[model samples]
Target: MRFYQATRFLFPGSLRLRMLALCSVGTHIPLLALAGWQLATGRADWPSLGLVIGATLVGTLFTLLCIDALLAPVRIATRAVAALEREQTAALTAVRDGDLLAELVVGVNRATEATKVRIATLDDAAHRDPLTGLLNRRGFLTRTEAARDGTVALIDLDRFKAVNDQFGHDAGDAILQDFAAYLARGVRRSDCVARWGGEEFAVFFPETEEGEAAGILHRIVRRMGAGLIDRPDGSPVTCSGGVVALDGETIGQAMTRADAALYAAKRAGRNQLRVSDAHIRLD
Candidate 1:
């Protein structure tokens, strides 16, 4: 293997080939001169000259053939790499002559498979919320096209700041997690939930009417808010939510309306569900 790899410099298609050709001529020239001198002195026969020429031609042909065989795998590898760049995986079948190159091709295929799996796993992790184990903003939007003709609800925890300030951020995180679990329990399998950042969560009800979506969000707000969070002091925590209807607008715009309704709910009084309507204010 080491010899084959090292002799890559001896192959054609390189500046080294011209240098090698020059060296071959230089070495063979002196030998031919000596042979001619022996022939002139009547010490060498014509048959011996023929034998030398034949030997040189056979040796050169064999060397060039071996080098060409070695480069075949490299060419195959180059094409395989191009395929891998275009797609995620490509297999090299050109090196199937039961040689070391075949082993290398098999290894490369296995490595490419592993790389593809690892990339897919990373993509999934990147789109998922680490804390709530729900879809993050990017993931939600990626799947939003399939979720059309649906209503999206923005669920913001009412007085979430009080929880963070009073019970500590850790406790606030725990409260949000608990709320997320409760909300999950309230939603159907057709619905998708996403952590839209901070204490705000968005829910998508696919192919659902506005009234049906409102009832579902109402349940989520009531059940999730009524659920208690056990603090370090062994006390309970509560939350509220704002719901909004969604239509042809982008998810961000729909979320803004929901957030506005959430703020309005907080302003009206904590622990209540406020649904956004055209008559409502930003409060």
Candidate 2:
């Protein structure tokens, strides 16, 4: 048996063909040796020896044909698995019902779907703020690349420390969440609102001019002065904002100018918007 198995290395073909070759060699080699010994000893005639050789050749051909037919389904299944690994399609179209290969294909499709869902969930968590559900500073920077030629605004809540002190931290948290929602609602679909840090937020308006962005901020200021934002103790919430144009300026430079303008707004009053002229060329 071991010698017959070793015959597989002599042939270059699929496992089915190699197995057939091994079986044929094992059977014929022994029968031919027996006939040769019988004829030399005058125990078998030439006619009987010819019959033995012809029978062996016919049997080998029949066995090889059967092996090829039996392995056809296995070859198709192998190709289907290769296609799935390449991410072409999830379905194994050639697979039939009530077979082990069909079950394996279904399991593979389910796993692929699960992997896709997990990746999406992780991406959302990475870009979102946990407390207010707004875009975090990193997310804001990543999504605001298209605002390079538009406007950037930095907003700071006025007297927000007093809110945290007068009320509780929980009340302060509620105010922040409500204010974030308000900012989102006031902006257009092309605009982005992000929580810059504690008590501060950033907005980016893509393809918008400085004056137009300032006008929008002014509206937000008027709304704040109207006491629209609700608090736990019925107190009014107000915010100061600074707007700057992104013309020929890097994001860092734009943010610095906007921050300076925000301080200017705070110094002038608690509820107003300031426009920065830092990027203006005197030429």
Candidate 3:
């Protein structure tokens, strides 16, 4: 057994070859020992020895071929497992029925699917706002890191504190959610809207210039001022916004200018849009 174990490296790195080598070694070792004993006792003739050796060799060859045939399914299953480990486009659908390999394939597929679902759930929770179903501040910042040129808008609800005081917290929350939905529907799919904080929302329009953004903001302001959003007591709910063009500035700098413009709009009246003229330094 020790000699057989040491000679394993003589065979190729294949399951079939290793099995054949082991079968041949086990059959020939005992025959060689018996022939040695017969020669020492002077009972082994050349013809008889040659015959025995030839018959044993033939039997060993036949047994090795049978072993190779029996292990062919195992070799296929092993290759499938290797492909999966390498992330190659291989499917284990051809596993034999009621076999251990079939059970392994099913288990592996289920685990992969469950892992994908878990990752998606975690990602959604991390990026989405719980109340408004929009992107939160963190998610927005992450997305805007790649933006080169566009428009940034900061919006604030007019007299939101009065609504919460007169109606209730629930009503205030409902108003925020409704405004978020309205903003989402008002913009293109390429735009991003985020809840920047309490009573404040931020929007990013990618690849849009100042004039285009101003026109869009004006339309939104007019639509909002026409009493489209209502309070519990049938009062009109309005919002003030500040729009600024992205001119080689970071998102943080653009947001600062927009916020300043938003407050300026709030001071000017209460339901209008203000465009910022802050010259962005191209750093």
Q: Highest lDDT: give the candidate number.
A: 3
List candidate 2 segments past 4 Å from native.
1-106, 278-283
Instruction: Give the per-residue lDDT of model 3 (tens digit) for 149-261.
Output: 99999889999999999999999999999999998888889999999999899999999987677677677777778887899998888988888988798988899999888
Best by TM-score: 3
Off by over 4 Å in 1: 1-98, 145-147, 276-283
| CA shift of 1, model 1, Å | 22
Residue 160: error of model 1 in Å? Answer: 2.4
User: lDDT for every model?
Assistant: 0.67, 0.77, 0.79
- Compared with the true structure, model 3 gives a TM-score of 0.65
Question: Which scores better on lDDT, 2 or 3?
Answer: 3
lDDT of 2 by residue, 137-239 (tens): 8888878754568899999999999888988889899889988988888888888889999989999888898888888877877787788785667867989
Residue 97 in candidate 2 has what lDDT?
44
Q: What is the TM-score of each predicted model, taking all chains together?
A: 0.64, 0.64, 0.65
Model 3 stretches astray by more than 4 angstroms: 1-98, 278-283
